[model samples]
Target: MMAFEFPGQYYEVIRGTLRDVHAETAYLADWLAKSGKATGGRVLDLGCGTGTTLRALAARGHGGVGVDASAAFIAWATEAGGDGLEYVRADLADLDVAEFATEEPFDLVVCLFATLNMVPPEALVPLLRQVRGRLAPGGHLVLDAAHLLGFVDTYQPSMIAHHQRDGVLLTRMVHTSVNGHTACWRNEETILARDPDGAVSMHENGFDQWVLTAPQIRGALAAAGFRVVAEHGGFRDAPPPPFGKGPLVQVAALDG
Candidate 1:
């Protein structure tokens, strides 16, 4: 495994780090609580790592189900589950979560923080469409992806953007190539802390992530039968070039 991939060592460090999951917490709790009038339904957190969002939703008095692909993360989430939360290790690229869909489709489906970038461009359409099918009428779809214009300097893209609490050091490297349909990013990470004290310390150990452009993300969602609702620059109607450290966030609604 390369430094720019989800390496095993990085996972162990992540399990120890990632203390405060406020980002997802804020998104889920706020969105589910005051997403306009009354929808009266639970929420689904896709690619939910450690079931943070799921637990957050539960805290907000809503039933939440978190889904991820990493078994380790899933197990951690499951242990963290219960008390009105459920975490499943299912491939979101191809999932049949009819049971949690409640035979009425989920009221909200979320894919936050460029979770879509991990998947290939080809799989996006089908994935979104499938998710759309599991959404109830008048439900909302909020998916996020990487922002293009946000990072033009590939060589010196960004420094070791550290997730201090998570003991993570993230380094990004953009591919020296681009196209209208596809774009890629290379993320190099390092884990710098561990349990049992000085026994296993890391000067460099972490995972990687590939990002996508705004257009590519939008096109995929539109093709999946979603109506462009409101895509803010950043978290809350920020500004252009809404990616990078800004965490390019997009919130859309699947139309029936």
Candidate 2:
């Protein structure tokens, strides 16, 4: 179990600018509809940082429970409470779906933004099995992970980004190291934040992630009793090669 920790306050401040939440949510909705799934379904969001995506889903009539290992993220998300939304702080490896079964089984389980890469390769099958046990009859799981090529192309040796919003300035410096032989990578990140009152803060964290291939992911899903239904290149319609230079997005359903 790798610890994927981030500065929650800084993350929340810059998340909206990091990606297009509306577009991502729309893409998810479209994917679900294309798979013949219904709207207004319950969702379980694994590695839901700051609950941005879950909040967007709720606005479109879906209810969701967001789980993250970072207490800061959970706290920030909980503070921004919305209808049909709940936040829980728990590591994915130690998750117990039974605790969230009060309503009904989840219609969809999402592990986005390469969150699954944080899970140790050996634990993936068991985690998938756990997710399978908590899904509705027609439930589906959608996830995105960094493939070998993507990792190589996207994660440079070092990079820096600066963002300023709402009287707060955030600077993130990232250093990435790739171990091709092991298909693993480590990211060391340092964050510098300047608040409205001119107070400065610095935070540092690092985590390791595995670069999985399409076949590897499919095999893991199959081992967990799931049948791969769709594979895409970074949320697009076209499928990426097994070792392409983009995020591998997959959708799987229980193999009955």
Candidate 3:
């Protein structure tokens, strides 16, 4: 299996442009408040690439840690440090909550943007159990994952996007394929960077990702002692069949 890794600076710039950080932060805050959670509470962000979400939360008086397996990502996030945010380099599959013993239990744990889908099948349940153990009572776990319906409807087998800003140009190509319950993704990025001296540099990188189905994810959460409290299609609350036309966003709480 190919290990997943971020393609560094150029990719981050393009990704940041693609996502609306403020909107996502607002959605998270609103969801938590409506669920009866405090506004300025501790948050634990898993697969937090570059810590943008945590940084936004910090501005709202929230504090927390961001965890990712990418050393490059950790370094970048650490450099862009927030007032009360810390970045840790660690793999979620083998996460050690003991490392965070000094801090209070997290009020919210998030694995957004289909990050949970990247967890290997064998480690999915164990990771969920670990996450459950780290949450304070009444705390919630919010995550989004790929599902068959969504994948089929939205992501084409092959697609490309381009963006240019701040003397940098990025072209990203996405290829996807599904076999059984697993979806395989390959991302190819080409970057052209211009310098003040009228010189240009080019860089290229590729990454692979595998995603499982919504039922598989829900089952893992249940086996890890969580009960689904709310389900949504791309952040908006929706009725079940849960596997709608968008990513499966689930809010789960510890079960009795």
Highest lDDT: which candidate?
2
Alpha-carbon shift of residue 108 in model 2 (angstroms): 0.9
**All candidates' lDDT scores?**
0.60, 0.81, 0.74
Candidate 2 residue 160 C-alpha distance from true site, Å: 2.0
What's the C-alpha lDDT at position 192 in model 2? 89
Candidate 2 error regions (>4 Å): 1-7, 34-38, 101-103, 179-182, 241-243
Q: How displaced is residue 123 in candidate 3, in Å?
A: 0.8
Question: Weakest 10 consecutive residues, lDDT, candidate 2?
Answer: 1-10
* Residue range 215-249, candidate 1, lDDT tens digits: 67778888888887776654555554433444466
Which regions of candidate 1 fall more than 4 Å away from where they truly are? 1-24, 34-40, 98-104, 151-163, 166-182, 188-190, 201-211, 237-247
**lDDT by residue for model 3 over 123-219, one digit each (tens)?**
8899999888888788888887766565556767677777765666665565555554445665555445554455666655555556666677789
Best by TM-score: 2
Q: Whole-model lDDT for model 2 versus the true structure?
A: 0.81
Query: What is the lDDT for 134 in model 1?
Result: 78
Against the true structure, candidate 3 has what lDDT? 0.74
Residue 219 lDDT in candidate 1: 85
